[model samples]
Target: MSWYQHWISFAKRLVHVVAKPMKQNSGQGGVMVHPYRGYGSSREVFVMGRVFRQAALGRAIPRRGVLRDTADVARRIFRRGLADARVDIRIGNNQLCITTDRDGYFDAQLPVSSALPVDVSWHRADIMVHAKGYPPVRTNVEIYVPPPEADLLVISDIDDTVMFTGVAEKLKMLYRLFVRKPHRRTAFPGVASLYQALYRGKSEKAERPILYVSRGPWAIYEMLETFFQLNRIPVGPILFLREWGISWRKPWPRRAEAHKRDLIDRMLALYSDMPCILIGDSGQHDPEVYTEVVKAYPGRIKAIYIRRVDQDPKREQAIQRLRDELAHTDCELVLAADSVLIAEHAYAQGDISARGLQAVQRDVDEQQNDPA
Candidate 1:
């Protein structure tokens, strides 16, 4: 209890406190980036950052209408700030203002935008930082913008084209799509870049619009967006089927359900006035559906680019029927190993010089050809 002893104890405690680990939040919402920790256990030498998704005040319920198991998901980060230090995240089309509670977690109300009824659903979210130091940082809001009017429309699939969902093995693809986490899915090569090129539109008028017409259900929109953002891919209006009803139990793997066909009708209506390019994969109903659409609207469709996933002779014959039929419509139907070549050709048609589109196309081509 001597004064000298008390001072000694205070010094020891200060060192321990400094050595304790700490975590903070980076400005990006929905992502956390930790620095690399060294041998030093000095907590003061490091910093941490976290982001959170929160609901409106007194509205503990997530506006998405789904109940989250926990309001907060805690993640640990070792070091502090560095290169690309902030987590890269997307501001979905529906994100709005945010607020923070005493604990420094972000909570916000996700806005409901269009009421347009299609099997096609959209998701919106905001970025709010939750961490120990610094005030909550809110990222500039960017909503998902649908493709503008174009001379050509691009509708495509997900599995086997954008993400490897084992479409070659139907049962496996279906199971993975329904059961896997967002982090588990693998994006197909050059898909993100191809999509971006098709969507960026050349000269606004010559710009060909793109649409993601996939058989995947809507339950994984967040995951889909995560994949796109993480890989720096392009964004577009995503069309998916509802999996909550009898649709799940349907035989033949995928039946042309009323909801799905109805969405196609809606899509056709959206492009009734413009000619379009249909980019699709042969893994599912795309061949049957795209073939029918091209047949119904003859000259309105510019071309059909079908990605072949199944090597089955019977299935290949069926897909070839659609390709053969495309000739009748005077629409060129070409098959490529992946979408990059087709997308490159589309970009060239859009008045974007070959050189103008090379950078993106190169990246896509590399991804498609890369062994890994």
Candidate 2:
């Protein structure tokens, strides 16, 4: 072709590229799926994600530089929720569909006639979603099954138990939540080691199930997931949360204690055959909720470990009362200020190896001695 002809062709291509933003930002949208994790014996599978239009492709993080990255990330998250849309997904041979609630997040629970193979710690299932007028999108979901011959299941709260969120102080809590990136967030001293010991139990190879329960919202799923990854904490399915957009219309959001309670109840029902170890904090109703769990399913609870975060005497006494109530059952409840003590309990209960116990104590001591 002549130079003039080539120039015309190049000009046309540049125009298309420049005009692409207009077409994209004109409110065109599609389906997205988050990583779904759930236990296997329940025969229940859950899929959750959002459908977005206009701005889903671009995150609104106000990244001026490193100094503002964390805050920017928070702003992006605040801008991301409350989108309601219809989504249809196929898991294996079964097709399940649902429309998202006002939160723009869809969580579909379906009992499969045949279990998806879960020969590993997590079974990955590829799912295809169909949204009319949009090209198909595929995402992976994981179904976790308790290991055979496993001794215990661990259900833990995230905010104060695993990490320090200052949950008792709302303003500070929001500041921490919005200002710290997952990589920079703090993990409670010796927590990851203790959880690892409990997960390994007597056997280093043991993959005892760990399910994380949070009162936060689904919008921060990726953030929490990143936190777990960065801190090397063993994580399972995370359950129970409101949608995560900050709203001025509703200044005070609905409490999620009930939602949290419901999830624990379901976990117990699903893992009825396995005794569980519950880890939460005194910051909220964990003690009360777990006490009810112990009563509801006698002998199903192996131990209840509530971290002493609030440091309120009344709260400690209240947890003590809950422990006393469980005396009739085999469950032992421990309310303490450090995870090292819990590691000792786990060791005595034979939930972890002697070496694992040593590791937990050592990590705790090291953290205590760290100048930072």
Candidate 3:
């Protein structure tokens, strides 16, 4: 192709470079974006916005902000990072704002005890001229719960295990899987009830502690929490993978996996000497990851429960491997139809009372057995 033709093609592709803005309606306040783009800048922008939300809510909340570029790069970045961004109100019934600033920062408010959808967005200041459209940013709200020490640390997966859709919903899966952020997620049958039981510590001798460890990016933490609170799922600390964006084949291909492993290690460190139970689905790496944890810390891990969302040969193989590895250990591996089965096991293992465990188990059984 001639030089002019090549230039034309390049321009076409550049024009086609799509920047999708995510707008999540959950109550939590944090920026959500693809995994690669999330770790550096968007997370910081979201945390900054959360301060505005907390001020409106009349309570102080722990907030964190990260500048997207590296320290060296940050120094060279635009002086007014996010300064060009603007938050404008009035978009039909919903009050909305958009940012076109260098730093991509925007502010929003969430009144205390108030439940309303707050929307914020980021776009290039130059791109606004065409008015093609501005993609809204995604935000997740984090709800704080007093630490539940000695309680059952009910860590579970958000994908197929609780939500009916396996591998997460395709339309939304990218947001969860690649974006590494939280958005609206589906609730699996009896998951809410089970989480409630675990969170409330309704069972005798069982601590009601809930923790979520998922492949979703950290950007979605607020969205995940909001979904939980909206659906009334048990609440707790949620661990997520950071978006490093570096291609695996390149210098940092293993960064994503390494980041996850580091996160898992930190989780174990926090719960060091703390007896805990694990809950997850069979859809993804949860099986293998959980197994490794059990093997690494024998008695510390109370139980391993995998939600049978679908049939997968590889998952089955992994399950078998976990069994083989745990052959000599006391850890129990179970395929629960729903949350109750886990509760039942906990009750039997003296984690909860017979009656309380039986009640939750029955509820899940009925939900799974229901024709609707």
Candidate 4:
């Protein structure tokens, strides 16, 4: 072809490329705001969310078809992170803007100038997230305003601690995660009642905040939510650790240890006056991590409970060493085999009432009879 003809063909191809839609990371469309439960004292409010276009990543799992379920499982197990999106949020009269950094997550700690009701445990506000291409998305956000009656806060790990997640065994963990519905999954005996009692704390009406931290990817957030609801556990902010991505500038996604520690630190700093109870299983880094947290803030931790999930002798010894190490501190480390032990300790500390202890015992007995 002549030079002019070749030039025209090149220009046409360029136009086609420019006009095509951007390659998307996930299948679904539309922008979404996934705000985690935020808690604050009366003077200020803190809120957080991930700004992203919907990918329908877990959409097929709940639809009840073999092929669709298989696809959803695959998506969840190998889910990709959608990141680096711009977002805007407005809480009450305070407006702030933040940009997601390679994780599609944004959080703002805004001040609450308006007066909050004295008795309520939660404060509601509208949170709006916007991206350049997608329309502005709005969602109801709750800033947990802890009541003055709250004695302490609870931060627990979900995997293997309360839920029977074979976290130490990769294949088994994947199999269980893919095959079961949220309701079908098992919660440890009496853990729900224990959590309820902790949520109610010293007073029967006090709804003290409970935060859940997990090492799993965000793809399973919906299923976890369903699981919490089905089990009648008190709902709180579900924080997840990122496990994808490695690069020259940022060598890893939110590192698991750092994520857990940073989140715990944030909570501790936010509620400086209230102590925290740390709970996790021995299958992973609970002992080591909780020990580090205790060391970081010596008097701030009220108690630490590491469930004995692993039967290994060395693991038990390590946890026992940690317990001994904390002997002089204000906190107590209890490595227990059942929720009964945890409930008993809480009762002794006046964290739960005698009636609440009885409820926990009843639930534990029922779970033994029928784990269904």
Candidate 5:
């Protein structure tokens, strides 16, 4: 066999040996429901979470130490998903029952008979998990409902665009993603400020919806959320992350293009009246996927900002072609070298206020000048 094939075979064997023990020992204590942030409109809501069987529920990402963080990553990666578990969701006076799929994930869309309160952008849903042998587990999940005055929606990718994970370099990306502590994972300079500007839009009280999409697995959700909090970025109502399956047959996860496309489509469908701004990095297939989205959705997209992470001329030329193709449309695809440029263009387009642009510039300057 070729060297690569031999390496894959060896790796698969090693995983089988190491993971079997963990899998067998998992979920021996009790069943738990881990709720994720949900999103909704005035007339309907979407909520989701996972059921896991674990001895004790611990923080997904530990507070300190690289070793503890790495161990937590392993536990999350090999979590024992409780398949076919029943889940009950209640929002205000409305109630619904759903069951977990094979992967222990429960996703439900329920119609809201009464209009949700517009005073607050976030609402809460109570989730209860019931398994055959375990006691019922209950948790509350927060759902984000954009205010009526919201005019713009922001959709951003998390990898190379928001943070400095070298997505084009798989090994380095995995190391930074899995090994680094949440506090240690660095966000791109001024990304938090730029995103905050987009979140606020033109008006200070716009309270627009900012949705974060990632190619990373659901296991890293807590880490990503904590990272955003640490960086002072506005947390989205919900993070759209894919469930990655790893086995001897499939060592790597599937391509993320379809996953990302479906998420953007769902967001567009949810907020039919809102025009969206798409943000992603040019290192991967974001430009192509976003271009397809613009075509599919017509004039729904106001602008597409692709962060230029590398100096590859060919990639730049390809993105430029996409930019040219979008010239006739109302949407403009901007390949920006930094967040300042994006902030400037957004200011000129009237998407953000002058103060917001200045905030982004100040953030960029501070990050650049910091010795650390």
Candidate 6:
């Protein structure tokens, strides 16, 4: 292996060793269920969640301090998954039961027997976890079902696109992700406004479906959710994150291109009739992966907006080349400097309203004036 790869491998081993004690120190508690938001059509819906044995009381991390923050992040990463657990989900009159896999994740698609009310865009599903000795743990998850009046769909990446993760700089990204307090992590200027505009759409009440796909691991789900809530970014039906499995043989997570493409494909298949707008950053393989997506699903993608995070000339040239290649097609690949540019393009395309555009512009100005 190369020097860089060897160093990464050693770091992973050290992290595992240091965090092992934290895992062992976890107090014996009852079973816990973490249900992610679900999405569906009128006919069926997809639900997913993870099962874990809860930590004891007073194990919660404090709101301040870097060492405590790092420990909290490590605790989350090393939390034990309860495999072979049974999960029961109830939607109105229908009920479905499924078992968790080795990773304690349960994902299933269920047919909707009773018609969901048209007045509401969100529905609820009651979830209960059944472990061997622990009492049944109950929770509820919200599902998003787009109304028929919805005109478009949006799929976006989280890192560097909507938020400032410094993906091109590994050390900075790691510091922001692991060491910094959650409140200190900030989103890009006007990103929340732009996304809210997209959610509202041209009619101002369209309520179009916005789905987020991330290359980050599932262990950081709660952190990401809190970030979204704090930033006021329009929350999507789900944040599709990969399960990063680090072993001696392979010390890193799977390739991000494959994971993002698979999630985008699944979302497209689920919402077959809706035309989608893709948003990502040029920091990694987003341009190439999205180019492939445009090729695979012709005439379905309306436009692609790539945030220009890297200033490298070669990267810019590559993205421009992709844009040129797609010039003849219905899908337009737009490489923009910020969210305001994207919002303007969407407004010009009649995808978002005039008020929405103004809101994004105002937010951009405010952030620029006081970017603390």
RMSD of 1: 17.1
Scored by lDDT, model 4 comes in at 0.71
Candidate 6, which ten residues in sequence have the lowest lDDT sum? 16-25
lDDT tens per residue, model 6, 305-324: 99998789999999999999
Q: TM-scores, in order shown?
A: 0.53, 0.77, 0.53, 0.78, 0.84, 0.84
Per-residue CA lDDT of model 5 for 1-372, tens digit only, reads 676775555444333333332332232347767788999898789998889876532556343444343444466566688998999898888788999998789899988986777899999999888999888877898999999999998999988898887745654443343434332337777888888888888887788999998888886676677568867889999888988877888888877998999889998999999999999999999999999999999989999999999999999999999999999999999999999999999999999999999999998888788765
For 15-97, candidate 4 gives per-residue lDDT tens digits of: 32222221222334466566766767766777776665544545544443344444434443443334766556555566666
lDDT of 1: 0.47
- Give the poorly placed runs of model 2, Cα more than 4 Å off: 1-31, 56-86, 91-95, 168-185, 244-252
Give all candidates' CA lDDT scores: 0.47, 0.67, 0.47, 0.71, 0.81, 0.81
lDDT (tens digit, per residue) of candidate 3 on 1-372: 676775554443222221111212122323222211111011111112311111011123222112111221222221222334354432123243455333334333212232223222221111111112334443333322223344545556665666544443644533332222221334665566666656556444333445565555444544455456655665554434343334545544344335545655655554454566777777666777778888877687778889877677777877877878787888878877667677777667876655556656676666567664
Stronger candidate by TM-score (1 vs 4): 4
Can you give the lDDT of residue 213 in candidate 3? 51
lDDT of 4 at 83: 71
Minimum summed lDDT over a 10-residue window in model 2 is located at: 19-28
lDDT score of residue 329 within candidate 1: 64
The deviation in Å at residue 202 for candidate 5 is 1.2
Better of 2 and 5 by TM-score: 5
Tell me the spans in candidate 5 whose CA falls farther than 4 Å from its real position. 1-28, 56-78, 168-185, 248-252
Residue 25 CA displacement from its true place in model 1, Å: 19
Quote the lDDT for 296 in model 6.
Answer: 93
Output the worst ten-in-a-row residue range by lDDT, candidate 5. 18-27
